[model samples]
Target: MPSIPLPGFQPPESIQEVFLNPGGFHFGTTDTRIVTLLGSCVSITLWHPRLRVGGMCHFMLPSRGVIPEGAGYDGRYGDEAMKLFLGHIMRIGAEPEAFQAKLFGGANMFADMAQRCEINVGERNIEMGLLQLERYGIPLVAKHLGGESHRKLMFDVWSGDVWLKSEQGRKPR
Candidate 1:
């Protein structure tokens, strides 16, 4: 896909950023600004307005079961990452109901991989995230999922808000 410039993205030479790799997660106050690139992966951002605390996780697979042996439950899986993310934010005094969630990064980027897997990882991720959120009764405020372009995700920890950009420069609904 040809890259389309995003409206809010800073020029390459401009802003400094903290980039989160797959399987990694971070939580903090509004002082944090984190970024990640995703394709056929999912990232969830949680924030509590009252507490002014927030978190973000970049997960590769829907579950740990799909990974090979010796791979312990980790942030790369949606289930495990959700647990860890919620746990961290809770430690700082965030309640389940107080959290507002925004989901991003579930794009079917490769045709070959999609054909081989027979299931879209992106779609599975969306389902898993929604199910888990429903289980906790946490409200999902927004989402950008299931497309053909990779996403660039950004989280502002203090406000617990996130923004998304893709090669197509499509904004969230």
Candidate 2:
């Protein structure tokens, strides 16, 4: 018996989909797509084409310094997230120096956040993303940051591509 191909049907590409919520990350060598929704949060994607491997992280806070009693330390902090990201990259037998990085999210979802809290979490996240990459000597290829709109980001680890879509009528400040 011969199986006939269905009309207008095509096999799906080999892609692993992962959704990174706040305080999460994913690392893989296969063709992977990582998605995240951000409002005053940030996500970073690192890819090493030579090794055909990559990783992504979504973090909500800047650091764990002076964490409240109930707010235990976690990857939700930018500093912690970076440590975890780099650790995993190294564990996977890849050096951080070889990774090409792309940064996304980091929108100031609140207008009065700075005045009230004396800081903008989104901007802080973006800053941490850039600073950490530079500190680790990773090549930051692209970045889409510092906006007032929420962002929906899709990152392709295999190709080192990040697709960013912002909420309607919102612009970077």
Candidate 3:
């Protein structure tokens, strides 16, 4: 067998796989990449233009206080995740005042769960994510949230492009 080289192709700088479990959050810098598989949880991406830095966090719960155990050491709740993500970007020389945001996930895949609460967990997650962005005064520029399907998101900090993959199709921003 002979090997053939593909044309017009370049390898990614680095690839880091991250699983945002039911309650998990993570932040990354321009040199680091972040990826997540989401269902009913919500993921928020915050980016700063001047510094070309960004971070993303996937949160299962809307508020940290809602969980009796507190967000623990992981800070998995949406509110805590937002704060941590913002802090991380700022630490990397990104200006908080110049940051923009984008939200994804928060799908109602488990419609059955909706009957248990006045508002669906997925909906609450989206609401809380937006609220957190607003509280931090970050402008939300884009979003691909809601519906009843799971999503896989890959974020490039340097380019500030978020790629979303779902059963239906792929959306790049």
- Clash totals, every prediction: 2, 0, 0
- RMSD in angstroms, candidate 1? 6.2
User: Model-by-model lDDT, in order?
Assistant: 0.75, 0.78, 0.73
Preferred candidate (lDDT higher): 2 or 3: 2
TM-score of every prediction relative to native: 0.80, 0.82, 0.78
Which residue pairs show collisions in model 3? none
Query: How displaced is residue 80 in candidate 1, in Å?
Result: 0.2
Off by over 4 Å in 1: 1-17, 66-73, 169-173
Residue ranges of candidate 3 with Cα displaced over 4 Å: 1-19, 66-73, 169-173
Tens digit of per-residue lDDT, candidate 1, span 1-173? 22244454323433235688988887766456778999878888888876766778888888866656776558888988888877776677667878898888777777578799797787788788877788787899988887788888877655454776688733323
- On lDDT, the candidate that comes out on top is 2
- Model 1 scores worst on lDDT over the 10 consecutive residues at 1-10
Q: Per-residue lDDT tens digits of candidate 2, residues 1-173?
A: 11233343222378678998888888875567788888888888888877767888899988868757776347788877788788878787788888888888788788686879878888888888888888889888888788788888887665566777787645664
C-alpha-based local distance difference test score of model 2: 0.78
